[model samples]
Each structure stands twice: as C-alpha cells, then as structure tokens.
Target: YRVHLEHYMTELLDLTVAAFDYESKTPTYLLTQFLSGIDWSVGTVNLISSIDLKSDKRITILKALTLLAGECKGELDFLENRVVDLKSQIGSNTQLHLRYDKNCDYIEKISDTSQLCTRLYCYGRDSLTIESVNEGIEYLDSAYINNYKYRKEKTIYTNIEVASDLKTYAEAYLAIYELPFLTYKVNLADLAKREIWQHEIINLGDTLRIYDDDLSLNVKVRVKKITKDYVSENIYLEFVNYLYLPKFDNIAEEVAYLSEVISNIVSYDDPTKVSVDAIDDLPTIL
Candidate 1:
C-alpha cells in the first residue's frame, strides 16, 4: 500500500493549525497557507478554481486539506522530501480491466442503505436555504431519486454563508447520502507476478473495470484500499460503487433460477377458462 499524507504529517506539533476564512482564493493558495502555518514546504500545484473556506476554529491540517480537496474534486500527493503536490484529481487516465480467473480467490460485495437519502434540506449560516439554488424548492433532490420508489429525506447544517458555496456543499452531501454504501472485496495473487506487474499496476484512487461474463456483470469502480504481502506473494484490494452480494458462483446460480422462473411463467397457459351452465343460468368454471 502507498503511504498516506496524514501518516507522514502526524507530528503533534505540526498537526493542528489556526484556521481563518479565505475567500475568492484558489485551493492551491489555501493549501500553501495551511502548510506555511505548520512550516511545511510546498512543491508543484495544478489545482484550479476559486472556492471559500469557512473555518472559524482551529482544525487539523489534514482536515483542512480534505475540505479543500472535496470542494474542488481534487487530491493531494505527498512527494519525496516532504514536498506536497495538489492535482485536479488522482489516478491514471487509462483505466485497467481485471478479469476473474483461476488467480482470483473470490469477489465479494457489501451494501448498506441505512443512511440513504434522496432529498436534503440544507441550512446555511444567516438562515440561508438551498431553496434558491434548488429552483425555489424547499430542498434539494438527488439525481438518483427516481431509482427509488419513495423519497428519503434528511437535513444538513453547514457554516457556509455564501449561497454559491452552500450550493456546492449541499450537492456534495446529497451525492454521498443518496447512494447506498457499496464495497467490493477481491484477492488476486496473480497481480504480484512479474508477468502481470510488468503489464499493469494499480494504486489507491485508481479506476478499474471488472469483468465476469458468467455472472453477466461488468462494472467500473474506484480503488479505495489495497494490501500486499510481498513475502506471501498476495495482493488484496477493495473497491467502491460496485454491485451487491458475494462469490460469483452463488450470484450466477440465483440469476439462473430467477430466469427459469420467468421463462416458465411466460410459457404457462391461462387458467381462467370458464363456461356457463345453460339450464341453471348460472356461471360455472370448466
């Protein structure tokens, strides 16, 4: 697994920094200020767009960086010699495809919908509401709302005072809450093999495609975690925004069974054939 910035910058003395609001500033500028506050050096930065940071209290430098990244859809790359780089986003432009075969131990998926919210009522500082940005509607709806039969509503409160900034915050919140928590677990020892490693390598935040023809499933997901044991020659990975259930064989069997049931229902004749009794002048079933 690659190193995380939080781990390297974990010194108690260098962790927390005084927060101040920086308006009409690019993310790169805010990042530099936080690093400078902690006396850390900076390197190349490729971030774009101006955003607001509404921090009024002291916050961890990591938290400050996270908020800045989230607002801009960007990520930080901690480089050698304590230099930090901010990019528009992390991961490779060329997505690699991984297929299930003998090397794959299994693929498992997990989903949690307990916190799913289709609509949100967001409140900003000074009694500002999402109503203005939401076309005069009292709340904002997720684009995924139509996927569900009924609406799931939730309320969110933020310290942001600007309408445009509040819109950004609420939309981000809705996007996360509207989707069910999904994760895919996969173990592929073959990825450690020199032959495979030479062809492709995966890292955190990279997008990947999974192919399983027998299960009739092909999905694209982002890598959330990775583990490798060099001594054991094993590699394990976790992905997000993927399908549900576990083990390809079980899912395939369930799908086949459902398909057969539908086939049988379609082929079966109607059982409502009825006849009338002429003498009694009463309806009778045949």
Candidate 2:
C-alpha cells in the first residue's frame, strides 16, 4: 500500500504540472502521450486529486484557445482596415476599379494547413472564440459571410449516409440539412437533371444534394466530405449546410486536452441554429 500510494502521489504531481503547462492552449503532443499513460488505479486520494487537477487544466487550456481565436481574428480586422484605407486613396490615375480584397490572404494566414486545431491553439495566448453556427450570426451580418450558398435547391434520392459509428453527428447533420428545415421542398428532379450540385462529385467523393419531400420545394446545399470507411454510402449520408456553420469556441478550447474527437461532436449538435461566420471555409455565400 505504501509503495503504491507513493508512486501514485508522485504521478499525480507530475500530471498536475503537465496540465498547467498546457493551460494556455499550447498543443504539445507529448502531453497527449502522457495522458494516455495515466493509470488512474491509484488510491482514492491520488485518483481524486488527479481528476480535479486535470479538469482545471483542461478548462484553462480552453480559455487559452479562445484567446488565440481572438488574436487570429484581430489580424483579419487589421487587414480589413488597411484595405479600407487603400480604397480611400483614389488618385487621378486610379484604375477602373480598386479590387483591394486581400481578405483571402489574411484568411489563408489563419486557415493555412499549419493553423489547424493543434497548431492554432499554440500559435498565441489570446486565441479566438469558436462560436457555434447559431452563435456567430451577428459577426456575419456585417458582410463577413458565415455560411455558403448552394447553387439552388437540389436533392438526389439515395438511401445513403456516411456515418454509422457517429450516430449523433450523422443524425445532427441530417436534421440540419434534411429538408425538414425547408419542409422537404427541395427539388429532386432538377438536382438529378442538371447535376450542378453533383458537378464536383468524383468517385468516393462527397456531393451535396437537395432533397424535397415531393419535388415541390428546394433546399440549397453542398456536400463537404465523405467518410473514408463508408464505400457504398448506402446508409451513410455526408453533407454540410451551406447555410449553417457550427461554432466551436468551447470545443476548440477543449482540443488541447482531448487527444481525439469523441467528445467534440456531442458537445454541440443542435441543428436548428445557423451561423454565418462558419462560412469561412466555403467559396461563396448565398
């Protein structure tokens, strides 16, 4: 008992420190490794202490991630101000139009494959807030697109879906995109006839389709990504709401602690709300 308790106590101390080190949203993969190694079979005293410490550690990391998001957003706004200033500098020899849209470049700075979840957290102290598609609506109202616009309401009929193990995500996505929102008014015939939505479709790729209850209504959408595991796609549906983007500020904050995505989807899956800033990834907004 003495040896076991002593060893666990020491481990608890080390883990506590590890957690604090990551309190600022720094994504050190080594910490994930360390967490995977935690036995947690120690006596009550050590086990309890470890759990409390870990929770605190994760919370701090989340706050740090939020700060990082703010920092990235600040960079974007700074660039926007510069563009405005440039637009104001119209001289006599000015061209027909001043296409001063460098926003894409700033967006790329943040969206660079490098600034993905882990790296994003570690990039700065004052991170950005990852709001849900519903929560970030106000931000997009000022012309910053929060959602993508579909070419038109298009739907293809198929008993296919993309996730089995991910029931919550699958269901939530369906609820958000499935004609239920638009009252199943999407046009099924036009989608198949013109196949504009399917224009981007390739073998083993995701294509957004609009589904109507009776070919009377139209719901616009785009298919984002397909599951690598589901080949037949018979019961696996993959889709993204061209109109709704789920914000993940808290979720992003938690990324520093979680080594996987098991909990992320569960945290926020309600489909009723739409977020405009979530359109950051898509090319166009309708």
Candidate 3:
C-alpha cells in the first residue's frame, strides 16, 4: 500500500520524475503514500484505500499476495479443513457454555451469531440484472452468473431490517477474541465450476454494508457441499436455529472487563485505537 501510494502521489500530484527514492512497487512505499491522505482523528486512522490498485506498487503487492496464496495453496487447503474443525469446536464450546455448568452458556449464543447466512439474488435481467437469486443458500449453481452478473457496487440493499440491535453481550464476546472466527476466506469463483453463489463476509459486506471503512465485519467461506439435503426429502423436522452471537451480564463493568481482556490481544499490534465496544453501545439495561 505504501509503495503504491507513493507512486500515485508522485505521478498524480506530479511530484517529478526523480522523487522516487524507494521501490515504487513495494508494499512499504504504497502504504506510505496511502497514509499520507489519512486523517487520524482521536488516534483513529480514518481514510479509504490509500494505494489505489492502478498504482504499479499496489498491483505488485496484489500479484505478490496472489503468488503467496498460490505458494501456500496446499497449506491453505489444509487450513480450510481445519476451519471446519474450528467451527465444530465453536459449536461444542457453545454447547458447553449454554450448559452453564461452570461452562457459561455464552458459547452457544456466539456460535449462532457467528454463522452468517448469506443469500444471493441477481438484479433485473435488463440492466446488469440479477439473473437469479440463490435464496435457499446451500443450493448453488452457475458460478459466473451468481457473481459478476449483479455488481455489488451498483446494486442497492432493499428492505433493511433491524432485528434487535447488536447485543451487548455479543459485542463483549466478540471484543474478547479480537479476531475469533478466523474469518475463513474462500473463493467461490475458483471453487465453483459454472454458477457462483458462494461467498465469505468481506466482498458481500462491501456491497451490503456500504459503511465500516467499506469493509465487511466478517469473511465469507464457501462450503463445497453444493447439494445439501433439501426439505423435499425430509418430512417433519425441528427448526434448526443457528447464526447467533452472545450476550453476558448486561453490567457494563463485567462486559468492560471482558472487553479489556480481549482488547489487549485485539489491539496488541496496533496503537490501541479499536474501540472496545462498551455497555453504552448496548440498550439501557433496566
């Protein structure tokens, strides 16, 4: 990012043909250039993409990351499987937590919230339309059609519903991990052959959540099992409820303590700017 940023400023701002002191294609220089425009209000780094991809340096880093991804593809694939184990661990821990036998029933709630159920629908058929929407979720088809067909940039989210504000306990739980939920990133395009309904949390969040630094809160992982057993096969069954976070004592102090515990790790490398979501972000506890 620094390298790319420097190149952008040098060329775009007309810095000159000789202001290039460092490698214009390095991440360091791109980051430097990107940080130049950032306004750190109250120690908060507030700025959008510093090194635009068009920059030679930014492109270089992109290629490098891509190359690194290729190099680590084997390990990455192994890690992907580990992600399933992690989820199972999360689910098991949740069960133990919910049991509340010195286990604290908090884990179950966290696991539920962690499962982000993403649904995809294409725009109208005429103008860069959503040729189709994979509403059922697990059932996916037509990779290219599922993805590029409806531009996340152009499409607008409809019927934004607020199903209860972010739970105070859940926020506290999240604050603890600083980065639990490894965010399991996966590529739907490469993973799929024809249609693309697969997604993680990042890209979708860009189009979905237009705010939050234009970045998604979580990363999406596409599970390979395309043909999940449909209800058409099974007759009567229990409503399996998942995709839930957690909430502990509404007490700000306790929650704050949890926040502090995680804060140490979350901002361990950073300058401690990530706001530890306090009890105030929660509803007034009666």
**Candidates' C-alpha lDDT:** 0.63, 0.25, 0.24
lDDT of 1 by residue, 5-83 (tens): 4445555234877768878898778888878855466766687678777788998887887777766656666554676
Evaluated at residue 185, the lDDT of candidate 3 is 20
Backbone clash pairs in model 1 (N, Cα, C under 3 Å; residues 3+ apart or in different chains), count: 0
**Cα RMSD to the true fold for all candidates:** 18.1, 23.5, 25.5
The TM-score between candidate 1 and the true structure equals: 0.56
Give the distance in Å from residue 143's predicted Cα in candidate 1 to where it truly belongs: 13
Off by over 4 Å in 3: 1-245, 249-257, 272-286
Please list the residue runs of candidate 2 whose C-alpha ends up more than 4 Å from where it truly belongs after superposition: 1-31, 38-54, 57-207, 211-213, 216-233, 236-286
Give me the candidate number with maximum TM-score.
Answer: 1
The model with the greatest lDDT is 1
lDDT of 1: 0.63
Q: By descending TM-score, how would the candidates be arranged?
A: 1, 2, 3
| Clash number for each model | 0, 35, 40
Query: lDDT, candidate 1, residue 46?
Result: 80
